[model samples]
Target: MSAKIAVKGLKKGFITDQGLLQVVNGISFDVADGEFVAFVGPSGCGKTTLMNIIAGFDPPDEGTVKVDGASRSGPSAKGILISQHGSVFPWLTVQQNLMFGLNGHAPSNKEQLADHYADLVGLKGFEMSYPHELSGGMLKRAELARALVVKPEILYMDEPFSALDALLSLRMRKEFLRILAEERHTVVLITHDVEEAIHLADRIFVLSARPAHIKATFAVPFEHPRRLSSPEAQGLKESILRELGV
Candidate 1:
């Protein structure tokens, strides 16, 4: 499989009151086209920083990040980053939010597209509803609808389900996997939830505590709608927990 995204010796740090604080230290990895990959690490381990650098939100101090074999110095038009907290316009109705990025299209065409994604994301009747009126899961589905409406080639999700309650997060994870299977967009997810990573990722990359680097990579062998209770899945979780030392 050809790599859709590649990073080599990527390094990033920030100016701190104490001094320069190195966060991502020589982190490197490749994401294959149409692949679902997860980065799992402790909190504040630069997982988000690494994600920001790859999505072109921040510049790397060293090395390179390439998408579709082209090095990127800034955010690519083909990529979209979904924040840990869902990104949606609080002021706009669900339909309007979906149409926000489709400005160049005809109004009728944009409406049609918004309706299509609204249905896909299970928000059909809630088109006129505002964000505050929705539940946590509904907000996420609405955000997904907004992102997918743009037809991005790659989706960079930063702990997308982190804000949801445990049960809601699990349900959303399943829903997300089903949607991704149909959409087949390459995904790079930054998450600290072990079970979430195990359930959704084709491969899981473990990063060490601060000055994060890839500590280990585990391939999830079971099929989607994975059995968290099954021995195989549980064992994989155990291995990952050992790597995390928690």
Candidate 2:
């Protein structure tokens, strides 16, 4: 299949007190249609900056980002970004939150769509719950539900589960995969967790520090519902860490 998302010679930088601070530098990659890809690197390596460019939230200083063969100009309704700190509304109930983006739709249609997505993300009974009332895992699920409700072509996840505790993170990974498989959602995840990348991605991109570039790319051969404790998975994790120079 052709690339659903293609980036070439992508470079980005920011102005700081120390002058221009380069983040991404001469990076290139392609995410196939319906594929789950992950970027893994040390902190400050610009993985999130690259993601933002691909998601059309930030324009690169050089090169290009294309989605479905078109150069990305800005954020499109076809894609959604789920930040590390989820964008859930504290005051909105789960039901109302789900309905937040469905403006202009008939009430009955919105209600049905909201209910369907709520159940899809395992939030069926918590529709009345507020964001503060839900556990960390549930809050992530609600955010996922909110994004999926709009039928995005791609999900830009910047460490969607990184804020949770270890146990909760594990559980959320499983839940994320389960929901993603059912929906066949395409994703590009930015994560510093090598284990998380190895466990979840179809392919992994290891990036260099500071002026980030693709140091290595590994195609994970294992299927989903991955056994993280298995020797192969552990071995891959070590390999990725080595690439990151950790």
What is the C-alpha lDDT profile of model 2 across 150-183, one tens digit per residue? Answer: 8889999998988988898888788888888788
How good is model 2 by TM-score?
0.96
Query: Can you give the TM-score per candidate against the true fold?
Result: 0.97, 0.96
lDDT of 1 at 52: 90
Name the regions of candidate 1 deviating beyond 4 angstroms. none
State the lDDT of candidate 1 residue by residue for 113-136, as single tens digits: 999999988888999999999998
Which regions of candidate 2 are displaced past 4 Å?
none
lDDT for every model? 0.92, 0.89
Which candidate leads the pack in TM-score?
1
| RMSD (Cα, Å) of model 2 | 1.3
